[model samples]
Target chain A: MYRISDQQVDFILADIKKHGIRIESLQQNLLDHICIIIEQNLEQHDDFEKFYREIIKTFYKEELKEIEEEAIFLVKSKGPFLLLSRLQFFLLLFITFIGPYITYDLVWFFNEGHGSVLPVEVWSGTMVFATFPLLVLLVLYFTPEKLDPLIPRKSKILLGIRPFIKIIPPTEKYASYQQ
Target chain B: MIYSSELIKGTLKTIVLKLLTDNKKMYGYEITQKVKELTLDRIQITEGALYPTLHALEAEGLVTIKTEFIGKRVRKYYSLSRAGKTKAKEKLNELSNFMETMISLLDIKPKTI
Candidate 1:
């Protein structure tokens, strides 16, 4: 229920900035929170500067720095993964739909005069290649290289079968075997 | 009378979600103070720790934040999104069940089953 003038707010902002809160949203939240804490203190204490100093003293400055660093990190690191996932999603979606039909036609074109049952090599190759995109997607989804974009960045744990998570798809290796 | 830091760490998310479930909306500082008051200062959620949780919750689509301008500063008030509301209930129920199980284990009565 207490209020301060613009000048006092500026001083509070300066103090927060000086302490190294760089994220814009965090700075804003901290500004409001600090002011409210100050107002609460003002009801009991007379001096703004002294009360403000004392309240911040209760906080771990390292923790404050951690908050800022965490926010920035969550944004910078996760932003790319989220984008990459979306791109991967769309790319895979496109291939899943279109790839099989193309593979079937290509297999048929080379072996048009063959009987109803296709050759084992053609059938097997088509099966592997057709399911390639989906297999990659399942691997990516389950063995998440990063945390869900929604989870806090600091909570990044290499979840789910960590040893097998870093699978390099057998596309190139399989191609070598084909030769 | 503060609780161990480790104990508080695991439960913080559920605590935040549960608090939001009970209240219409709460700001960062308000959430901290409420937790302190409710627990009689035994559980103090520091500003440093609380903000990350809130941000993470926001990212998870569990909570939606509304920013209001009061004079020169911005006040961010967080409320549960629809999914958040459901998640809050589930998390609290899970925690309640876990607590009951822990209590039963400590009591150590041999089961007839």
Candidate 2:
């Protein structure tokens, strides 16, 4: 077995940090794990830096920062919540808010006692109240990736008691790694 | 010879929790090796997924960690907390039931040892 020098260990740690892993414990975990692999595999004469880069590349698809992002995302998404995708949330808003108003108008139209035609204010009210919010939600849900800061295109949304609501940006790379 | 990434797509947490329950404690690499050994190298847990999940479990208070200095490196060991023990049982039961359901649904025959 090859023994890794302190300098080689330091080089690994710096490389991990430079790759964008911010959390200390996570950094250390990667350090120890990579060091063990090096000790077990690499011989003393081999190029440590090149071998290290080759191995770490397999850790992520795009970059190392995804791990930190995923860690933060999972922590925030925990506890009681209604997890929703983009389309589901949009439909939920429509059903909860707009559906009721449309139902009210339908019921009024067919009723024997009330007039067949809706008052102008009632039509205006539906147009005024429901349309604005519905449009806002539509825009928020469908906003382009660069333009939309709150919810990314593929992110999961959590609606809950504690945090009220949160948007977890998608990490499709590691999404399959967990349930 | 197969990698079970597709087969084990969503059961990483249950596996880890159960491992911690069976053993007193584990570190990141040890957990990976144990899984590989137990599964006959069919299931390999990646560092990208393992560290984050472990960190999340710690943040959620399902697991506790203690570090020891080994020369220049610090080795962190993880053990289940009181809540983690309860959680592990629940997750195991859940996964077991899910497997049973999958077996029934797919009408696959279980191989006898």
Candidate 3:
């Protein structure tokens, strides 16, 4: 017969609870499974720790991220909204970059191109330079390896124009954490 | 033995539900251990895989949790709800049918003339 320490049992139970598995009847079910493995390994003259590691290794042959993805998928087909919110932020980048440019262009056209040379050139040039790089960054951020081919080129170009959406926010470092 | 990953994947929910059905009440480690025992130590359940499944089942309202103090720590015990029991039966029946089909289809060996 194989024996599990109370501490080990506690660790396992804690992990299960943390993951949100609430079936108490399954508790002994898992224990029985592990007990059999340990017993077999002991019979074969393997050390307890070695046997334990082998069993764990066999069970989780895939990467941790893959396991997490499967679990998340199983739990809720519609994933957490936080990720969707991030995608929305990416979409907003496009609007921010293009909005000011369109406004500026329309104003210049209506005024018969009479805007101040220094300010107009400065503003328009700044928007162009800023938006271009910002769009590149967004593309790199959102483009998943497998889904690259699925993305429309028009969307990619629109994304490239997203950086000039607003004036770049000033950077500030908080000092609250300083001892 | 390393079974096809697909085989394990399809039956995970059924396996879990059946385990719960047998034990009545158990915690995380206990569930894994029971599966290993019943499978004759051929199948092992990992913490990485098990925790997420448990959480998913809880989220689906298939299981209910009760907490108990053990020494300095609290242990969460899991048991099937009424819905879980019904679901388990359905899943088990589905699995049994699947197994029967698989066995019938694959049990034949080719004859050498």
List lDDT for all candidates, in order: 0.69, 0.83, 0.58
Q: Residue-wise lDDT of candidate 1 within B1-113, one digit each (tens)?
A: 79976677668889999999999999988899899999999999977667767776787789998989888888999999999999998999998998889779899666683
Better of 1 and 3 by DockQ: 1
Clashes of each: 0, 0, 36
Candidate 1 on A1-179: residue-level lDDT in tens?
56776787889888878887776767778888888877765864478888888777666553456666544333333321222233354465557664775668677866786556676887677667666766755554555445344222222221122221112221111111111
Question: What's the distance in Å from true for residue A31, model 3?
Answer: 15
The count of backbone overlaps in candidate 2 is 0
Model 2, residue A55: distance off in Å is 0.9
Per-residue lDDT over A58-146 for candidate 3, one digit per residue giving the tens place of the 0 to 100 score = 54444323345445444444322222223454566555765567566667666766554436684777677667867775665567454
User: Which of candidates 1 and 2 reaches a greater TM-score?
Assistant: 2
- The top-ranked prediction according to DockQ is 2
Q: Kindly report which residue stretches of model 3 are placed more than 4 angstroms away from their true locations once superposed.
A: A1-69, A78-179, B2-5, B107-113
**C-alpha RMSD for every candidate:** 12.5, 3.3, 12.6
The top-ranked prediction according to lDDT is 2
- The DockQ scores of all candidates, in the order shown, are 0.23, 0.69, 0.18
How should the candidates be ordered by lDDT, best one leading? 2, 1, 3
